[model samples]
Target chain A: MLVSLAWRNIWRQPVRSVLSLIGLAFSSLLLVFMLSFQFGVYDTIKIGALGLFDGFGQFQPEGYDDDPDISKQLPGSQALLAADQIKGVSATAPRASSFAILANGDTSFGAAVIGVDPAREPAVSTLYSTISEGRYLEPEDSAAIVMGAGLVRNLGLALGDNVTMLGTGNDGAVAADVLELVGIFSTGVNAVDRQITQMPLARFQETYNMGENVNVIALRGPDFNGVIRAAPDLQGLAEAEGAVYLRWDDLQPEVRQMITLDLSTAMLMYGIMIVVVVFILLNTLYMSVLERTREFGGLMAIGMRPAQIGAMVWLELVFLSLLGAGIGIALGAGITIWVENVGISFPGMEDVLGQWGISGRVYPDLSFFSASIGPGIIVGSIIILGLIPYRRILGLEPVSAMGAA
Target chain B: MKPIVSCRGITKVFGKGELAVHALRGIDLDIMEGDFATLAGPSGSGKTTLLNMVGALDHPTAGEVAIDGQPLSGMSKSALSDLRLNKIGFIFQAYNLVPVLSARENVEFVLRLLRVEPAERRRRADEALAEVGLQGMEGRRPSALSGGQQQRVAIARALVARPRIVLADEPTANLDSTTTKELVDLMYRLNQESGITFLIGTHDPRVMEHSKRHIEMNDGQIESDTRG
Candidate 1:
C-alpha cells in the first residue's frame, strides 16, 4: 500500500517530476556514451601507438632491447617460424638495425636504418602501407632501399636516388653500400620521417656480415587482445630460442600513462555532473515533502508512523531513480550498440590524427564497465542523498503539521 | 462507565519568557466510554489544544493523559502511533484525506497499516464507504468529492478501524447548512448504532445541538458542562 501510495504521489505534480526525471536521464545518457567512447579510444591507441611500429609484441635476444649490440643476435629464421605458428599470430618479421651515415651529392645525414624482409614487413608493421611515394622493395631487389621523406629530403635526394650508406658491421669491418632509393615514405612522425630508413634483409646481411642472425623478431596479431592472448605462447617460443617476449604495455609505458591521464580527467568531469544532478533531484524530493506537510500530518494522526512516512518518501525516490536511469541506460546502450556497428567518424579530422597512424573513425568498446558504472553511480547517489527529505518527514509533528497551509 | 479518554491537570505552553501563551491551562477532563461529547470555544480558547492532547497528538507541558487506560507521557513515538492506530480515529476541519487516494482507498489505508489481509481490507473498506452513503463514489479521488462528501469519507475512514474514540476538530466548518445537518445526523446515527465515543472541537453551535454532552471552553478552561 505504501508503495502504491508513493507511485501515485510522484504523479501528483506531473510536470515537476517529469522535468527532474528528464534531467537525470540525460545526465546518465551522456555519461554512458562518453565513457564508452573513451574506453574505445584506449583500444585504438593501443594499436596505433604500438602496432604502428613496435608490432604489438616482440621476440628479442634476452639483452637485445636493453642494449642492441650486433653481437647479441638471435636465430632470425627459427624464431620467425616459431612465432608465426602461434594461434593469434597474423604475421611475424625479423629485423636487423644499425645507425648509418647516408649521403647524396653534397648533402649528408646520419639516420637509423633497419633491414626487413620485403614480404613479411608489410604484415608486421604499418610503415609498409605508408609508402607516400614510389613502390615498396621486392624480395628479389637486394640493392633497393626505402627512406623516410624527411631523411631523403635532408640528404637532398628523391625517388630513384642512389644513397651511399656507411657503417661498421658485426664482423668489426667497415660495411658500405650504394643502394638505389626505390621508395620514399612519410610516416608523419617527426622521429620516423626525419631520421629512419629501411633496406632489404639480404643486402643488410651481406653488407653488415650478420649471416642469418637478427636482433629481434617482431609479431603482429588480429587485434590488441588477440596479440595479448598469444603472448604466453610466444613467451614459450622465445625462451626455447633463447629470447624474451615483450608485450605491448611493457614495450610502451607511455601509452598506459596517456590513457590513465585521460581517464582520470574524464572521471572528474563525470563526478561534477552526477553531483549537480543529485542536488536537483534532491531539491524536488524535499519540496514535495514540504508541500504535503498537512497531508503527512493527517496520515500520522490516523495511524501512520513517522518512520513509515519516511519510508514512503524513500520509495518515491527509488521509483524515480529506477525509471529515469533505466530509460537512460536503454537509450544509451542502444546508441552505443549502433555506433559500435557503423562507428563514429571524424570526417574532417583525419589529418589531425593521421600522424598517430589513427583513422578518422572509431567504434566504442561497449563493455560492462562503461555501460553500467555511470548509471550505477547516479542511482546510488540519488538514493543516498534522498535521506535529507526522509529525515525531514520523520521530524514532522502531526498537530503542527496538520495546521500548515 | 469508565472513562475512555482522561486528562488530569493538562497544561500546554507555546514559546517561553514573556512570549509564552498558555494554549491549555491546567485542564482536567474525562469522556466516558461511548459518550458523544463536543468541546466549544472561540479561536485561541484552547478547544483544539485540548483535543490534540486528548488524541495524544501532542504532549502536555505539565501533567499526564491516559487514553483507554494507557498512560501517554512515557510512550515512544512508535508506541504513541500504535496507540492512536488502535484506539483513535480522526476528522479535520479541512477534510484531511490523502488527496491522491480514492474514497475507498482512503478508508483502506488504516486497515493496511494494521496489516489486515487484502480480501478483508477490501470488504471492510466497501462496507464503511457504503455506511457513509459513498458506495457508488468508491473510485472517486478525494479531489472529486464535495466538501461535505469528503467529510463523510473522512468519517468512514475514522470509523473503519473500530477505534474506541474519534477526534473531530471542526469537521463541518466548510459545509453548507443542509450538508452540515446531514453530516451531523449521519454521525449521530453512527454513534448510536456503533456505540463508538466521539470528542469534537468546534465553534459550531449546530454540532452542539447533536452532542449528548457539551463542554464549553474559555481561556483554556472548561467554562460550562451541559447535557443535551
Candidate 2:
C-alpha cells in the first residue's frame, strides 16, 4: 500500500513529475555518451600514434628506448621469429636506427637514419602507406632509401638522387654511405616528416658494420587488444634474446600523459553533471514535501508515523530514479551502438586530427565501465538525498501540520 | 473500568510570552464506554483544542489525557501513533480522504496501518462502506463523489478500525443540512449498534440533539454539561 500510495503521489502533478524524470534521463544519457566518446577518441589516438612507426608492441635493446646509441644492438632475427609464433601477433618487422647527417650540394640536414626490412616493413608500419611522392624501397634494393617530404625538401634533394649519410659505427668507425632516395612520404607529424629517412636493413648493417643485428623488432597484431594479450609471451622471448618488450602505452608515454589530463577534464565535467542531477532531485522532493504539507499532516494525524511517511516519499524518488536511469541507459546504449557502427566524423579537420593520430572519423568504444558508472552515481544520489525529506517529516507536529494551510 | 476517553485539567497554550494564545483552559472531562457525547462551542471556544489533546494529536500545556486507560503524557510519537491506530479514530471537518484513492481504498488505509490481512481488510472495508450507505460507490475517488459521499467514506474509514473511541471534529461543518442530519443519524445508529464510544466536537445543534450528553464551552472553559 505504501508503494502504491507513493507511486500515485508522483502523478498528482503529472507535468512536474515528468519534467524531473526527463531531466534525470537526459543527464545520465549525456554522461554515458560522453564517456564512450572519450574512450573512442583514446583508441583513435593510440592507433594513429602507434601505427605510424612504433607498431603496437616492440622488442628493443634493454636500454635503447632511453639511449639509441648504435652500440646498443640486439639479435633481432631470433626475437622477431619468436614473436611471429605467438597466435595473436600478425606480423613483425626488424629495423635499425641511429642519428646521422645528410648533405646535398652545400645543403645539410640532420636526420634519424632508420633501416627497415622493405619486404616486411609494410606489414608493421603505417609510414609505408603514407607515401606522398616517389616509391618505397624494394627487397632487392640495397642503396635505395625512402625519405620524408620535409626531410628531402630540407636536403634539397629529389628522388633518384644520392644523399650522403655520415655517422659513427658500433666500432667507432666513420659510417659513410650514399643512398638513392626512392620515395618521399608525408605523415603530417612534424618530427616524422622533418627528421626521418629509411633504407634497407642489409644495406644499413653493411654500412654500419653491425653484422645482422638490429635496434628493434616491431610487432603488429589485428588490433591493440590482441597485441596487449601477446605482450607477456613477447616479453619472455625478448628477454631470452637480451632485449625488452614495450607495450604500446609504454612506448608512447607522452600519449599516455595526454590521455590522463584529458580524462581528468572529462571526469570533472561529468562530476558537474552529476551535481546538477542531485540538485534537480532535491528541488523536486523539497517542493513535493511543501506542496503536500497538509496532506502529510493528515496522514500523520491518522496513525501514520513520520518514518513510514518518509519511506513512502523515498519510495517515490526510488521509482522515479530507477525509471529515469533505465531509460537513459537504453537510450545511451542505442546511441553509442549507432555511433560505433556509423562513427562520428569531423569534416575539414582531417589534417589537424591526423597530426594527433586520429584519422578523419572517431568511432566511439562503449565499455561496461563507461556505460554503468554514470548512471550508478545518479541512482545512488537519490537514495542518499531521500534522507533530507525524512528528517523534515520527523520535525512536523501532527496537530500544527494538520492545521497548516 | 476507566472511561474510554478521559481528560483532566487539560490546558493548551500556543506560542510563547506576550503573544501566547491559550487554546484550551484547564478542563476535566470523561466519556465512558458506549457513550455518545458532543462538545459544543463557537470557534476558539476550546472544543477542537480539547478534542485534539484527547485525540493525542498534541500535548497539553498542563495536566494529561488518557485514552483507553493509557496516559498520553511522555509517550514517544511512535507510541502515540500506535495508540491512535489501535485505540482512537479521527474524522476531520474537510472529509480528509486521500484524493487519489477510491472510497474503499480510503477506508482500507487505516486497515493497512493496522497490518490487517488483505482479504480481511477488503472484507471489513466492504462491510464498513455498506454500513455507511456507500455500498455501490466504493470505487469512486473522493473527487468524483459528493461532499456527503466523501464524508461517508471518512466515517467508514474511522469505524473500520474498530477503535475504542472515534473523535470527530466539526464533521458536519461542510455538509448540507440534509446530509448533516443523515450523518448525525448514521453516527447515532453506529454508536448504538457497535457500542463504541464517540467524542464529537461541533457547534451544530442537530449533532448535539443526537448525542446522549452535551458539554458546551465558552472562552476555553466549559459553561454547561448536560445529560438527559
Candidate 3:
C-alpha cells in the first residue's frame, strides 16, 4: 500500500517526474555511447594492426628495429633456433626486409620490400590469407613481387607487369633490379597495403645483394595468455644481442597509451552523467518526501513508529530506482547494439582517424563486463542518494508535520 | 481512576537566544482513563504545547510528562515513539490524510506499520470507517472526499488502532459549524460507546460546550479545570 502511495505521489507532478526520468536516461545513454565508441576503436586498431604485423609478441635481430638496415640481419639459422625456444610461441617466420624506391613509368614511391618464406609467413601473419584476388608468394616463385592493391594501382602495374627496385645494397654499393608482379595483398590497413611489397627470401637476397642475411624474424603467439607467458625470456634473449624484443604493444606504445587515456576519459565523461542522474533522483525523492510529510506524521500519530516511516520511504525509492534503471538499461543496450552493428561514420573525420591509425567507421564494441558496470553504478548511486531524505523520519515533528506544510 | 496521562511542571521553549519563545511554562495536569477533556485557550496561550507534551510529540524543556504512567522525559526517542504508537491516537484540524492514498489505505497505513495481519487490518479498517459513517467510501482518495468526510476518515484512522487515548488538536478548525457539531457528536458517541479516553485542544466554543470537561489556559498557564 505504501508502495502504491509513493508511486502515485511521483506522478502528482507529471512534468517534473518526466523531466527527471529523461535527465537520467539521457545521462545514462551518453555515458554508454562514449564507452562503446572507445572500446570499438580499440578493437579495430588491434585487429587491423595484427593483421599485417605478426603476433602478440615478436622476436627481431639485434638493433633491427632501431636501424632496420638490411646489413643488420641475423642468420636465418640462428633466428629459427631462437624462435623455437619461446614457450607458447605458435608460429615463426624469417623475413628479409629492406627500404627501396619502386618505379613504373613516371610514378615512383618509396616502399618497404619484405622477403618471406611464404609457407611460414602465413602462419605468422594474415598477409597471405588477406590477399583479395591474386595468389600469395610460393617457394618456386622467388623472382616475383607481390604488391599492395593501392600501390599496384598508383604505379599502374598489374599481374605480369614489370617494376624496378633501386637501393644501396648491403655491400655499400648502388644496385637496381626489375621484378614481375606475381600477386597482391590487402590487409585493410592502408599504410601497409600501399607501401609494402613481399617477395621470397632467397630471391630478395640475390636481387638486393644482401648475401645470407635476414633482417628480422617475427613470431605469432597463441593468445593474450601466450604473449604474457613468453615476454620475459624473449626480452632476455633480445637484450643479449643488444636488440629490443617488441610485442604488439611495444610496436605502438602511443596507441596503447592513447587507449588507456581514452578509457579513463570515457569513465570521466560517463561519471559526470551518473552524477547528473543521482541529482535527478534526489530531486524527485526529496520533492516526494516534502509532499508526503503530513502523511508520514499521520502514520506516526496513530501507533506507527518513525522507523516504519523511514523504511517505507526507503522501499519506495528502491522500487522507483529499479523501475528507472530497468528502463535505462534496456534503452542503453538497444542503443549500444544498434551502434555496434551498423557503426557510426564521421564523414570528414574518417581521414583524421585513419591518420591516427584508427578505422573510419566507429563500431561500438561493448564487453559483457563493460555494459554491466553502468546499471550497477546507477543503482548504487540511487541507493546512496536515497539516504539523505530519511533524516526526516528521524526528526519527524509529528504535530507540525500533521498540522500543515 | 488511574491517570492515563500526567504532566508535572512541564515547560516547552521554542527558538533560542534573543528570539526565543516560551510556549509553555510549568504546566501540571492529569486525566483519568475515561475523561473526555478539552484544553481551551486563545491562540498562543500554550494549550497546543501542553497537549504536545502530553501526547509525547514534543519534549518538555524541564520537568516530566508521562503517558500511561511511564515518564516520557528521559525515554529514548524510539521508546517515546512506541508509547505514542501503541497507546495514543491523534486527530488534526486539517485531517492530515495522505492525498495519494485511498481512505482504506490511509487507515491501513497504521495497521501495516504495526504489522497487523492483512485480513485483520482490512476488517478493522472497514469497521472503523463504517463506525465513522463512511461505509462504501473506502476507495476514495482524500482529495476526492469532502472536508467533513476527510476529517471522519482521520477519526477512523485514529480510532482504528484502538488506542487507549486520542488527542485532537483543533480537529474542527476547518469544518462548517454543522459539520463540526456532527464530528464532535461522532467523537462523543465513540467515547461513550467504546470508553476511549479523549483529550481535545481547541479554541472553538462549540468544541468545549460539547465536551464532558474543560480546562482553560491563560498566557502560559491553565487558570481553570472544570468537570461537568
Candidate 3, residues A1-405, lDDT tens digits: the string is 556656776677778777766766666665566666677778666655663565556666666666788788664446453665578777777778888899998888889988888878887777777677678898788678899988998898878888998877878787678888888876656787898998888888887687776777777766544666788877777666655677777766766887788878877877887777787678877887887787777766665677767776877677666666666666777888998889888887765665454556778776665565776688778877777777777777777777657
Model 1 lDDT tens row, A1-405 = 889989999999999989978987888888888899888888887888777678989887777777878777886457455677788888888888888899888788898778998888888888877898998878898898999998888888878889999988998899899999999888776678888888998889889999877877788988778889887788888777777888887778878888889889989999998888888888877888888888889889998999999999899999998888888888888899999989988888776666556677888888788988998898999888888788887888888888888
Model 3, range B56-135, lDDT digits (tens) per residue? 88778887987788888677767777787788888888787877789998888778767899999999999999999999
Candidate 1: give the clashing pairs: none
Candidate 2, residues B106-130: lDDT per residue as tens digits? 9999999999999999999999999
Segments in model 1 whose C-alpha atoms lie over 4 Å from true places: A59-93, A117-120, A137-143, A158-162, A170-182, A200-214, A225-250, A335-349, A362-365
TM-scores vs. true structure, each candidate? 0.89, 0.91, 0.81
A395 Cα displacement, candidate 3 (Å): 3.7
Candidate 2 residue-wise lDDT, A150-248, digit = tens: 988888888899999999887899999998888999998888999989999999999999998888889888878788888788888887877888999
lDDT score, residue A182, model 1? Answer: 93
> How high is the DockQ of candidate 3?
0.53
lDDT of 2 at A38: 93
Model 3, backbone clash pairs (residues 3+ apart or across chains), number: 1
Q: Model 3 lDDT vs. the true structure?
A: 0.79
State, as a TM-score between 0 and 1, how close model 3 is to the true structure. 0.81
